[model samples]
Target: MANALSFTFIHVLCLLLHCSASSAQNVVFQPSFLTIHGPSMTALLYGFSSKITLNLQAIPSSNVTGSFVPPSCVPGVTQWILTSELIAKTAVQVKLRLNRSLRLCGNNETDTDCCVKPLCVLETLQLTACEGNTSQASLIIQVKIYALLGSGNMVFDNSTIIQNQVYRPLGDCPCDLTFNTCDLWCCCDKDCSTADFKLFRYRCLTGPFGGQFPDPEYQCSVQSTQNSPDWFPFLCVTSPPENNPYLGLFYQGNTMAPKPGISFGGSVSLAPALSNAYTEGSPILTIKDQYFTIPQTLNGHCVTNAPVAFLKNLDVRCVTSVQACPTEFPLQTIPEDLRAVVKNGIAVFVGNVVVDVTDQLATELNEFVTSSDIFGSSGLVCENVTLALDYNFHWKENGITGITLTRTVGSVTLKGNVSLTTRYSAMFLSGDIMSEPNSGNPGYQVGRPVIGGILNTSIGNDTVLIARSPMHLWKPVNSGICSSADVRPLLFGENSTSGCLIPVSRQNLTECSLLRNSVHSLQGALIEATLVARNGHPDALTLADWLNITYVTLNSSGVEDSNSSCADIPSHLHIYLWTLVSGFVDGIPQKDIKAVQISYSLSSWRLKCGGGDSAVCMDPAETQLLPITSSVTFIDIPLNTGPPKTRYQINFTEYDCNRNDVCWPELAFPITRFYTGESYSQALAKGLILVFFFIVASVLGNPWRQIRQIWNTI
Candidate 1:
């Protein structure tokens, strides 16, 4: 029994030792050398092992290849805590780095290969290893492995690859999927579905090699419809040429046909002919079918084409001459001695002789002469003379009343007393007048004449006597009788009165005076004629007699003294005597004759002073003669023979000199009065009292209210 038991114990001991050695020998290759089974050949490995802990080493002589350090085993757990260097190397070793923390977990004698619960063991380990010593050599991969507590074959299913999965072709290499060939979701097999194919197609289409397409409507061109044989066609192109001949052609076409109305059928064959014709005043184009004519004359030439239309019609006439056409012919031929006479717009004979017109008279003599006969007589008398009669004069015997007598050369005298009494009539004679023998009537008298009447006498050297017995005489109520003489007085002699006569003279005469009122109620006046002293002789007649006068009225208004009147003053007073010196006898200079003196009677009481009880007597004889100067001072006098000089003196004297008691000699004559009783202080006091009362009244009276009330009342 002993010998059998000993043998059993030895067998058990051997078995335990062998199992332990086998456990130690189960070291894993870091990556199970993967062989891809389909279209591609590359593979990868990942994991860790215990017996063969990877001691990553630097390649032989490269300094950049770092030295290797092995992983450590935990004392109690059947897991491994990889050193950061080893896991970091594995994580960084792949072409694309893996984002995972690797762990190893399984049963061993100690925690040699397996990792704890949350930590994963790398099934495939990839490490970058250098080939040789040189930095120029390519890098080679070094992998490590670890075993698991499983009876089946250990598979390296990378949890990092499974968790972060992507759609990659199973058998294709990662490098083969490039931007040039495929999109990010490229598949190896061609049996992809429509959706998957579209996805890949989109990726490929958007890839680098797929170029851009052209726009759909490009390369079009536009053509204009306005085309002709003369006009080139215009094209509007999508892309215009840099040096486009067609563009030039398009502008040329526009020049040919600028607007729609242009046509091109005409030819230029007759151009030279047309030019030649135009030069020859026969243009091919004509306006209104008329040949235009160039003007032959410039300014200052009378136009033969005054009516413009007449120039085209060629039918106008020209003015030949101008002549006078008289209306009424003279009745008879004037005598050869008679001066030239124009009668009824006709020029008669040009000499001095009388022509008898008894046969040519339009009225019977019948103790009268007609206007035509009288005009004929005037026509026989003067040269260049005209005569006209009123339209009422008839061609019969009754119209013979108005007759005219004219004398041009010899002195003509009226031998009979002529009387004219007619309405609308005139008696004109330019000769002498004389009373008829044994005829009581005076020369040329008229009575009670009416409208449109005149009696004009222009005598050379003659006297006219108008009798006063025909009380109406030459005095008509409304009509006028003017008599002018160049020599003797236009006289109003005995029996002639109350008529006007004007005498004109060329010779100076002594004692020349125009007499009037020689008979009763006769008045005569002369104007614009001078009465001179002849041979330095004074007028012989008194001035009052020289100018007829009767009575003078002074102070008719009774405001001035009636004793200022004088009787029989000159009717025609000379302005120089009345205004300055009387007939130059006073010898007073015009400048010194400033004022005139006159006296008026005054009562003694009127000039007295004081009240009625104690009045002082002031006699009229005591009134002073005070001369008051005018404010207007004389500057100079203009003399005919010498230079002008100021020649007058002026002084003032007060009229009421005796009123004031001051007796200031410098005060001249006028004495002014002053208030005697009141002092300035007293006046000021009174003013203040009035002012105070006024202020109180204004304040109490409510003046603004009163004003408003008054305004409202209106």
Candidate 2:
């Protein structure tokens, strides 16, 4: 019976051991207040036989409270002691504050003044009874801390087992097991373990999450970075390809040929209304039995072998008559050398004269003569006749040499020392003899009709010489007297003051004055001469109705003893003379002819004038020879007394003489009158000096004033 009791005891012991092992293998504890930031509390109860002893202890919680309580037992101990039996009888509570507040021990001990909160230590409870008989009890607690309540889950195991008087544990109660959900710590290298529970392993939704899955049709687009490798993948999946339409079927890489359509008729017939009758709707003629025809003629016209007559075999009316043939009319014959002829209804030179007989006939006689032979007894009579001679000649060949007679006249002659040199001298004569009367006009005294001539005579060395003057002998009276009065007789030597003569005693007079009145006939004459006389002699005169001199030289140095003589004639008149000169020959050498001068003597009514460097002079006393009138007047001088072929001219209108007005001075003055007061050189020098000072003052004065102003301001 004892042997049987031992076996049963052994089997009972084995059964108890098996039950203890199974119970201790894993322990579970539930947590209270599983918040993300606070500590979690898990309560564990040891499940074993009531005979076993357990030690009740407190483990420092991760988030410890300032006041902590150990695990309670059915049989409470006065002091904090842990035993195996107490553990099995009562549940052990471990209040773990994940982020615990700890008190810092220092000189300041009040809870409010504590520097730091006390840290809880991770611990395990031990129960020992006679060391040999030992068993371990473990509890597993799972705590889920979330960013918010019911957000996420976190599990920790706090299980342990005692084997051979030592505890074998899977892990500590996951001390400092933290979770974070804050985005601040969720980056690649950040510590997310301290972040809020919701931040741990958190992923962001593409759009707002309202507890519903994203729509499948509405794709969740991912924004790709510029550097992303898979950037083109999205484009390939979203877009598709399109097809082209302009392709044709191919055979062996070549285009296929299209099938042909049906053709119904060989030729179509059009109605007669749309066709030409001549063409027979064919537009051609056919010779063969073929489907086509060749065009015989274009434009639907018929081809013919013979010419066609448009109008044929019509009876035409006719009138019979006879027309006369034109007869040749008799023409008037012209006789040559008859001086006048008529041909073709035109009366040409009918006689010796080839008369130009138009409505108004103009005859030009290049060579003209006036004599009884050509003019006959009646003389050449006309209403008005103009005879123009470019140059005249009639002179005694022995006296005047190199003289030209340039006048329009009926006759010419030469007397005195006049001589002819040119072979073609017109109307030349010798000696100073007079001609006798001829037939016709028996009572007319025609001793030698005063002839026109030009004489070039030099004043000989003999103090007394005499010549008949042509100008004083027969002055040109009006044309009304040409018929009644005979021309004055040509004379030589000192005859009478009334006749044409030059006294030998008056040879001291300048030759210019002698020929001055020759041109007064107003019948065209151009005379050029050189005259020499004493300076300021008043006899030196360049006289003409109009005179133009190119140059004049004065030799006043020949005068005795005076430093300077009046080498220039002071008075001059210019009718239409254009005079250019080198310089004025003045008594004062310094007086340059740069300006015009005018001097007048009111007592004598005399005026003296000078031009700037001209070689002409006038006599102020000659004003008496001009006609006096109240009206402005012009003197018409015939440049040539001839037909329209000659050029004629007139002078400018001169105002009438006014003795009462000082402003109307005489139009004559000395040559030095233009420069009477001011020298040209002195005026020019003064002007330049004034200009120089003006420029200098303008340049220096302005800046100096500015400098003074600036100095005053400073």
Candidate 3:
């Protein structure tokens, strides 16, 4: 028996050494001797290899069963100690040698007698071991065997944690997966500091129990109950910690559950639908499964795939590449079925430019493309390249009603691909008026156009009707001067400051007092009217709501002579617009323009009067340049926070648990003892008497029946 046991130990070590030698390149452990079949007590062993050493520690039957121990050898004499030699970096030469005094039941004892003493075991047994450290009993080898005659066998199964294992609280902590980082007020995350917990202003994504079951705080709160406590009935659960309504049974397991998938699965879809109104970060959908995109300038080049935002006005020109011409452009309007509710009509008229849905269907331009009509007469295919496209969306309170697209087609080439300077603009208008644009729905939003009108006192009550336009900012051109070509409108909630140098010749500044007047007129060009909430909805705004300009008067009090150099041209204009937010709709702030304040600055530039050109500065030909710098700053301010509203209300009352069996009127177990008309003492007596009767009857009935059977036999 000793020889056979020694051979079995050598066989297991040889198999492990061979496996380790073959699998040295891979670090992943694959043991050939351990095949975990299932929960059933059967397993197959294979010689698998890994870089780590496996230690086997035997647990005595006395230690496991707490009573049984084989008497074959003395108490402390028989020992199963497994030793190993590290021959390779990835391999271990294991040699398990049991004491020589250890005896086998198969050689000298019957199978039943051996099993009763657990003496006669199989020559070879399957064992599962875990890797542990040197200072501790690292590995525990559990050997399972069945059917001593070899008819059926018990399976052995186990898992190993090499060095360490993290056992957090029982339930799932999905958001608390980051080890040392705070997971946004995750209740189960111990890494979160007090400051991190203070940031939990809203509802907790993971509850206080951290996804654990039998949470009394959340389940038995005041909102969950309908009845009040008895004796003192006005009491309501006020706080989450103190709101514990007693439930009799509370059993929970403390086992960590594993997530089903260990890795990311597939792509997530974030496609937007036309039937729904555009929200934050919503993508613009068009026909042919393409996004309706506009060119955005990035790093001195146009990215043509940038999508246009809904309800926001845009006009941009950039040199971009395009395939073909009019045919390739997104011409098809949004489908009618997918369209949201439209409160206003479809077409909008903008002075000479009539924006209608039918304009997109027009094949030839009236003045631009006159003498052409899809000509194929002389093998000449005049390619109508789309130079510009203007998309005007007519909308009301509901949603966008119709889209009007007017394309500027030019015959650039006969056929192939070409790059052209393409202009694209998207505007949202209400009904048929293009001058009157809807700033927002009910309240103003960031990036929406700011409505303003030129106040004309000549029209009396219709002063807002003279020339209504969205507020515009002077687009800077070469050398910091404003240009008539580029036009940029002011958007709500965007604060910006810009300046440009208007270079004027010294002679021109002296000759033309009209130069300062011209600068004044240029400032007034974009600064048209009083800022309004919305252009379409004309309100009777007070004088305080109207914007007032600053820095118009120059520092030329004593220098009114024609020979005097121009003193202090209007230099800077600061416009401040204040808005008030009352509430939020769909997480978007609802704001109204409250006040408008405008101020300006004036300064003078002194030149060397002794110079050749300075002597004849008043002369028409002396052309030494004098720069008149002017700046415009627009500041938008909103309230710090929206108006506060009540979140939760509580009604407190005195309720005593000692006076009443059930604190609340609702019946609960254990707490609820006596029913109606039943005294406490009477109920207790009746329960005790019933229990005594049952116990007595169970004890006496069995012997009486046996005695009656004996008497009948006699």
Candidate whose TM-score is highest: 3
Q: Identify the superior model by TM-score, candidate 2 or candidate 3.
A: 3
Error of 2 at 502 (Å): 99
Question: How well does candidate 1 score on lDDT at residue 270?
Answer: 13
lDDT of 2 at 355: 12
Query: On residues 292-401, what C-alpha lDDT tens digit does candidate 1 reach at each position?
Result: 22112225332321211110111111111111211221211243322211111101111111111111221222111112232233222212211211111111111111
Candidate 2 local distance difference test against the native: 0.25
Expressed as tens digits, the lDDT of each residue in 581-684 for candidate 2 is 22234432111011111121111111222454122123312311111101111132333456432132223223323223442334322222344457766655
Please say which candidate is ahead in lDDT: 1 or 2: 2
Candidates, ranked, lDDT: 3, 2, 1
Point out the higher-scoring one by lDDT: 2 or 3. 3
Q: Which parts of model 3 are misplaced by more than 4 Å?
A: 1-290, 296-302, 308-311, 319-387, 394-404, 409-422, 429-431, 435-450, 455-467, 478-485, 491-495, 501-503, 531-564, 576-595, 605-714
User: Against the true structure, what is each candidate's TM-score?
Assistant: 0.11, 0.11, 0.38
Residue-level lDDT tens digits of model 3 in 1-714:
665565556555655564454345233222344321111121112222442344333324332223321111111222345444332223333434433222224555555433433232223222322222211111212333221322122232433322211223332454576879988757657788877778883546644345433334333353333442231122233444422332111224233344231111122211122244444234544533355565566676767567656566667767544443345433212323222212121122100111232223334332222122234343224454555668777655534545666666555432233344556778777687652446666677677767676555676754443355566666554234454234467777787666555555555655545766776677666666654543223444443334443323344545443444565456565666766675677998777666665555555544445745455445555444343333333444645645553342122222434455656643332223636457767766776776686666644556666878899999
Alpha carbon deviation, residue 580, candidate 3 (Å):
7.1
Q: Count residue pairs with overlapping backbones in model 2.
A: 66
lDDT of each: 0.24, 0.25, 0.45
